[model samples]
Target: MDNASAITVFTLSGLNGTEKYRIPLFVVTFLCYSLIWVANVIIIVTIIMDKNLHEPMYILLCNLCISGLFGTAGFYPKFLSDLLSSTHVISFPGCLLQGFVVHAYIGVDFSILLIMSLDRYVAICRPLVYHSVMTRQRVGLLVLYAWLLPATLVMVGSITTFILKLCDSHIPRLYCINYFVNKLACTASVANFIIPACTYTIYVCHFVIIFWSYFYLIRTCRQSKEKMSKFMQTCLPHLFCLKILGVSLLFDLMYIRFGSVDLPQGLQNFIAIEFLVVPPILNPVIYGMKLTQVRNRIAQLFGKRDPMPHKAEFLMVEFESSCPNPPQDPFEGTQHRHEGVSLNQDIIQAFSAAACLASGSRHGLIRLGGASSGSHTLFRHGEAVFKLKQQVSELLLF
Candidate 1:
């Protein structure tokens, strides 16, 4: 213990073999880190700023992005420096700090996922009670749990490493981790192994809670298409994120515990780093794009507008093909009405299934013959309203 206490720095050998392509790797790593910050900040700011997005579900989503940022911030900055420098090393105190940040980030993430799955279960299966049960105050508590539980649990493990007299100062991996740091202890106490074992076990129970919630959700939604649709629309992103985090973390844990030394350095590096690399960037994207409200809000934030309201009942999505070459008056002789909707309005809307306003933008007026006054919108660029109102006899749109 006396000899081990003398060591104050650790050497990371993970980047030792990357001398040939280190520059390119540094460039890519820097971009990935930059992207992680931008993506997460966009989600965080968008949710905070949008009033309609103040629901419990979106609130939980904001935390997911926050965890992604927290976890990656622990690893990326130091790693980018390691990529450019000759020595991949960290001080003993710095190593423990990294481990705590990484572990606590993952711990918070697991708790958040568990809460998200249960939120879906309630919203889908017991919707009558969802609001009463998951109020803003309750959601605040859940967010608190998401942050504190893992932090407390991971802190115990980090502290044990801090007190241990580290016998080895060389870490064979990319960055600091509790599991790896514990291996540095001169004499392994049962607390060294038991604290982490208990932490991992407790967090693994989060998975049990998640599965318990989703199992009922899937079964309940099986009989109702509407419920199923809601499940797909809302819960799919949560489940997809779970899969991503689960796979990446699981592979990383497995690699660290049982990975073969014979494996190539590149594959080993990827396995070790994927948890930090993939989730931060992907979490924001899936949540932002997969969930309708976030996607629409993002579009609005960028000055784009949706011309049509999202309700499909009000929208007639039918389209038709335009003729390659046509007589000036294809529908000149006939006037038709489908259920009191004039041929004029029908052609204007359910025109060729081929050409319609993209994103239902009011921009890009389509000119058919001459121009008409109001209620005419361009499908794209600012043409005129399609003159189909001039001749709406028999428009053929399948």
Candidate 2:
């Protein structure tokens, strides 16, 4: 344990065996792993196939689903194997690869989540500029960077860390994480914790700022009483995502702060399984249940139909608009069509004369206007009746 050459491969003694519970544990974990895989795949597929879900928010979700898919795929197979066998041991190379993949996908997931938050911020606050700000090209670049940068950084870091390790044999917890595996190094120094602490702190600060900004955003939206309900509706889903993220962070911090730091042979493996394997399984279930859209989509996939609220609303508007306006004038009289609903010039002229006589001596009573042709005289009252008839005809026609 003291020398650089002391360990060649790590052995993991997983969860303390309670002989009565092994089969149930294996069955439960297996089903969870299977559900996670299938659910994430469905999410990805729905995002791709549904045009309604092709917006920036869903694009980010699809990226997250892909991240979770990879994250779970990277560790679950090994973890499941361990659960089945009740043995925890990972080869050196397998541990390194697992650590790298975990780091890469997790980094990518957070990076995308931050971008998604920004996307929501813009959509809610500066909706007019959201499209311009989150154009397809810009979002695509962010997605690429979210994935590639993390993969590259983790690859570089993992390779260097693996090379620096003095011992090849260290039993990783049920699976491997960078920190869990690094804990076994005879040469590990304060730098291991220091580097990760700084990196994690930077992300933590970013997350704090983003949450504060969203707080201001929610306040600003609430100021408009008209949008209060809609604001809540939109904010709820994002809030759920934030809550889950916060809960995960809380678990991580609590474990690091209060849980044992000592790298006991059996304990590291258990931590690995808890940290890497459990969270991924929880994500889709937590978010899926909290997000109405995802739940509705799932319901649809299961052949349940959600009545289109907007369409019904539109129909209601149309129906109300179709209801006849309260009768305006009793003498409005039934309109007659002449020359395919063109006004009846002779009749209008007659009515104009009667209206003028009945109204008494008016200065503009018989005011006549030249027609567009400059030859025909258009009587004022006649013109009024003519326009009224035209409007009535148009309305009826519609």
Candidate 3:
């Protein structure tokens, strides 16, 4: 209590007694941080630049990567610098800010993953209404909720922690946490305990809601093989991401309460920073490798394309146009009419093209294609087809 007024900086004793390994640790940390930035930046930029990827699902993923970047930025820079220096100290405000960013990042991860699962549910269980329900405005709003809710909770919690009058200036971990900071309080209050409990309870409810939604998602997928493939393609990555987050955060929480000095220092350090290191790197990689559209786009960027068969290509073999005066030739555009239904000329242009980006209908991707391209013109809306060939090498559809 007597030292409460004199402290301006806190010592991070996590780096204690590891002086000899500092350079090696710094190198590894730097590379890890660089990989985090590269992986995340690739995802963010790829989603933003590719118009084919502008769907609700991809948009949500972009935000996920953004949040990954947000959270890791708070830890890695400081940790890297600390690894190289004999004295690992942080100013009062810096400690709080780091805590705020890291915690908010965790909050955002929980909210976004839940939002993503709901998105998967709607897409798998209610394909027809997916677009209508996940409208641009609604998606924007959902994303807003994902970000604002956690940020608000974390800010309030940070404020609560900030008001504490601490008697000690040493944090044993590599970073600051409101929980530990509160432990240094000259005195304790009911609000401190109440607020943290409430915050954690809310996040727990988020997990509950997500699991329930996935319960239904799994059930609906079992009804058909197509549905099952969709579930495996899209939902698996989300589950993996959720698992990464759960395990890392859970270990850290357990360590906070039950950590024993008998544990190896390396093990303790890993537990404390697992969330900071693992999730940021794996989230982007998992989504990239799992999702069809994202994976194809990334491959395309690197001048490689994966072969995928498309269902839409078979339907495009022949289309009847009710143009007032339709061209008899499929290759050359003309006006014709049949059954009083008119097909737009754009269909001919779209069907005639061969190399398409393959993110065709907002409704869904093309899933079936082994039938060769035939001499028929169809009014495909969003696909580009220059099909004068007897066979399509392969149609890539997201």
For lDDT, the strongest prediction is 3
In order of lDDT, best first, we have 3, 1, 2
* Candidate 2 worst ten-residue window by lDDT: 312-321
Shift in Å, residue 150, candidate 2: 2.6
Error of 1 at 36 (Å): 1.1
Error of 3 at 12 (Å): 0.5
What TM-score would every model get versus the actual structure? 0.78, 0.69, 0.81
Q: Mind giving the per-residue lDDT tens digits that candidate 3 earns over 6-63?
A: 7779998888878889999999999999999999998998899987577788898999
Per-residue lDDT tens digits for candidate 1, residues 164-221, read 8778898989988878878877787788878877887887788988999999989998
Query: Each candidate: what lDDT?
Result: 0.74, 0.58, 0.75
Clashes of each: 10, 9, 19
Name the regions of candidate 3 deviating beyond 4 angstroms.
307-317, 321-398
Tell me the TM-score of model 2.
Answer: 0.69
